[model samples]
Target: MLIYSILFPILAIIAIIVFFFRFRSGKLSLSSFFIWSIIWIFVIIFSIFPDSSMVFARVFGITRGLDFIIITAVVLLFYLGVKLYYKLDKLEDDVNKIVKEVAISNEISLDDEEEK
Candidate 1:
C-alpha cells in the first residue's frame, strides 16, 4: 500500500513531464498528447483509489479486482503495441520511398554526365 502510494504518483508525474517535452518539441501532436494525458490521469486516479477497481470489476463481471486490473493492463499494452507496430511500418515505408527516389535521381544524373 505504501509502495503503491509513492510509486504511482511518481510515475504519473514523470509521464506528464515526458508528454510536455514531446509536445513542446513537436514530437507529439496535440491530440496524441491529450490522449496520453488522459491515460496517465486515469493511472493516477486508479492508483490513488485502488479499491475502486473492485467496483469496476463487479460491473464488468470480473471475479477479482486484481484480475481486472491485470486484464486491463494487458489489453492496453497489446493495443499500444499494435499501434506502435503500424506507425513503425508506415515510417519504414516512407523512408524506403525517399531512399529509392534519391537513388534513382542520382543514377539519372550520373548517366546524363556520362552522356555529356
Candidate 2:
C-alpha cells in the first residue's frame, strides 16, 4: 500500500465528518452535503484501489487512468462552476430586490408642498 492510499482515506473521512456536522447544523443544504459526500467517497475509493480507475477508464474508452481522472475532474469542475455562478447570480438578484423593497417602504418625503 502506498502512503497516499492510507493518507487520502483518512483525510476523506475527516472531511466527511466535518461536512456531516455542517449539514446537521443547517449550514449545508441536503444536495450540497450529498455532493460533497459523493466526492469524498470517490476520493477514498480511488486512493484505496488505484487500479480501479483503469476499469473506469476502459469503460470511458480512455487508454490511461490518469487521463480519465483528469477529464472527469475538469468536467465536474465546469459543472460546479456553472452551478455556483447561477446561484450567486440568483442571490445577487434576491438581495437587490430586498433592498429595493426596503428602500421603497422607508422612503423619505422631501417635497416642499408635502411638508407645508
Candidate 3:
C-alpha cells in the first residue's frame, strides 16, 4: 500500500507531463499514452501483490527483489549507453563526410584561382 501510494502518484505525474509536452508540440500520439497507461497499470498491480518481491526473486533466480531490481536497472542503463554510443558514432560519420566534401570543394576552388 505504501509502495503503491508513492509510485502511483509519481507515474501519474510523469504521464501527465509527457502528455502535456506532446500536446504542446503538436505531435501528440495515442501510442505514448497507451504505453504509459500499461506501465502504470503493471506497477500498480505489482505493488498490490503480497510477496511480490519474493515472486520476482524466485522468477529471476535472485536472492532478493532488491537484487533483481538492481540487475534490471544496470542492464537498462547499459543498453541505453550502447544506443547513445551508436547514435553519436553515426553523427560523427555524417559530420566527417560533410567536412570532407567542403574540403574537396575548397581545394578545387583554390586550384581554379591559381590557374587564373
lDDT of each: 0.91, 0.92, 0.74
Candidate 3 has an lDDT of 0.74
Candidate 2 lDDT (Cα, 0 to 1): 0.92
Best by lDDT: 2
Across 1-116, the per-residue lDDT of candidate 3 in tens digits comes to 58666777677668767776886687866775666566555555455663575677788789877676568668867987997999999999999999999999999999999999
RMSD of 1: 1.8
The residue ranges of model 1 lying beyond 4 angstroms of the native Cα positions read none
lDDT of 2 by residue, 3-111 (tens): 9999999999999999999999999999999999999998899899988889999999999887888999999999999999999999999999999988766665435
- How far in Å is the alpha carbon of 75 misplaced in model 3? 0.7
What does the lDDT read for residue 52 in candidate 2? 87
Stretches of candidate 2 off by over 4 Å are 108-116
Which parts of model 3 are misplaced by more than 4 Å?
A: 1-4, 15-51
Residue-by-residue lDDT tens digits, candidate 1, 29-103: 999899889878877877888888799899999988889989988998999999999999999999999999999
Better of 1 and 2 by lDDT: 2
